[model samples]
Target: MTSPSDPIVLVGLPGAGKTTFLAALWYALNHSTDGGISLNALPEDQAYLNEISRTWRQGEPQPHTATAVFQEIRLCVRYDGADVPGELVLPDLSGECFQQDQWADRHWNQKYDSIARAASGVVLLVHPDAWKGSPRIADVARAEQLIEGSVAESQGEHVASGGAGRAGADESDQVEANVVDFDPLRVPAQVILVDLLQFLIGDPCFHTALRVSVVISAWDLLESRGRTPSVCLEKEMPLLHQFLTSNADRISCQVFGVSAQGGPYEDPRVRQNLLQMDNPIERIQVRDADGNTSDITAPILWQVRDRVVEERECRGIS
Candidate 1:
């Protein structure tokens, strides 16, 4: 069980903007070394956490987003009439971790199990580019196996129809035959995957989480494709929304087109052009099937509140 002050875990593939989102989230929440925000209670082995803070403090910043190894960030905030201290932990695991035989260790698997149990919720970072390519049948199959296995180990039931998308050649029989013997009741109540690009056309994992939020990072780059932020989101949200809702009943998912980098990057040829400056304002526009667009900022404190604080309440953890 997690207290209101417990940490929230962020798990996803590499280069999925986990570290960048954390940095932006921290800044958005009005946190600083002098302002009573610090990771005083984190484990002693968390050197990466310290390094991230040090980079921001020293004015010589490095990429704090995702690394080959896991990292964590801690923040303190007031939300929903409670004074809360939150931590966001990003596992070092990349998409490759989902491959067969990589996650077979009992110790390794247990770490994620313990974290999920302690965490209020989860944010799964997914790369949009992975979705745009021809769907690797193997990738799809492995993702299904992973979700099925994880849900069973966690004791959660598979709520969506296993056969909804099976269109050809007895896939239902194949899925049933290959179904790993696992229980589903142990799965966590809230899990949201963040996608930097909404390109994984019709991928199935989005429906696995109780609620999914699709976020597009590097919004400025989309302009090169002859699409405005509003126009891009407008085109993508409907397809994603219908797919998720049509597939699952227990799951309630929404799409939010977001840009972590507020605008385009500076040209490299110019002498005064800085490299990778933080966006002063990050925007996320939430779009549902009803065509409602609600513009929200991707603030760290609020994200902690939404993903952690509220999740604790729902789980009756307080």
Candidate 2:
């Protein structure tokens, strides 16, 4: 997974907090040198991520990435006691562009295909605030209800026509009927996501590799509203969660909560919290909402260790 051809890509829709995660990950890697994980990028490579970290620390939202523009952010990484070093390439894409690629007349991009195929793994950032489930869930439920009602009304007619049920099954062994048409108002976010997963998964029978870290952005906001990240994901992006989880054979998935800037700058205490969390040695330090630092590097380490283990397993090495 550390090969130049195997970059760990960070992917998400616009407003899904991809920028925030990238900035936060970069900052943690650079600032927290003691976490058994380290990042060394050239000075020229440092400028972009550096500025992003700075902007985020200043309490302003980083700009969303522009559509159709592909930039590769690569970093050399080392764990304190690892035999080999690794390089990760983060993807540059806007949510709109991702959406467009999924639904735009099946248009193909050579660059996207190559990058995805070559990816070592992926970090899929998700923002609860940005994803509100489609109206289709309710629509589907209503349709199901209508279908059941109509089916009940036609039961006698079906029996008279000798079509009481599906052929060759016991009367008591009824199979559930499913609606063929799930009338969605617009191309749903999940639909796009499903298509993207299909593209990335590449093979229908097997997944060569797909490591996904689900970072729930603005975690503090969810906590403030008395919600857990898991609950938020279940409520808001259940389809994505279900889709990813269903493919456990190929997709190694994990969920984490991180508040990069802690809170927005508008909050009077944000600046002070940054002051404390800005400790040079403790890059994982994240300020509390009330403003005290806590560790933010554990999730990254989890990814690293998981990647190492999986890569070794794939190679059939003990």
Clashes (candidate 2)? 2
Every candidate's CA RMSD: 14.5, 8.7
Candidate 2 structure quality by residue, lDDT tens digits, 1-318: 344226666667667777766777777786665555676555355777888788765557788777766767766777544446666667767776666664555654677666776775677666655566465577799989997786676676677879777432433344434324543325566666667666677644334557666777667666567655556666777788788878887787776666666665567676566556645233223322233344554555555675666666766766
Off by over 4 Å in 1: 1-7, 30-47, 50-68, 72-74, 80-95, 98-108, 135-209, 223-243, 247-249, 263-318
lDDT of each: 0.41, 0.64
TM-score of 2: 0.71
Clashes of each: 15, 2
What's the TM-score of every candidate structure?
Answer: 0.47, 0.71
- When summed lDDT is taken over every stretch of 10 residues in candidate 2, the lowest stretch is 280-289
lDDT of 2: 0.64
For candidate 2, the per-residue lDDT at 277 reads 61
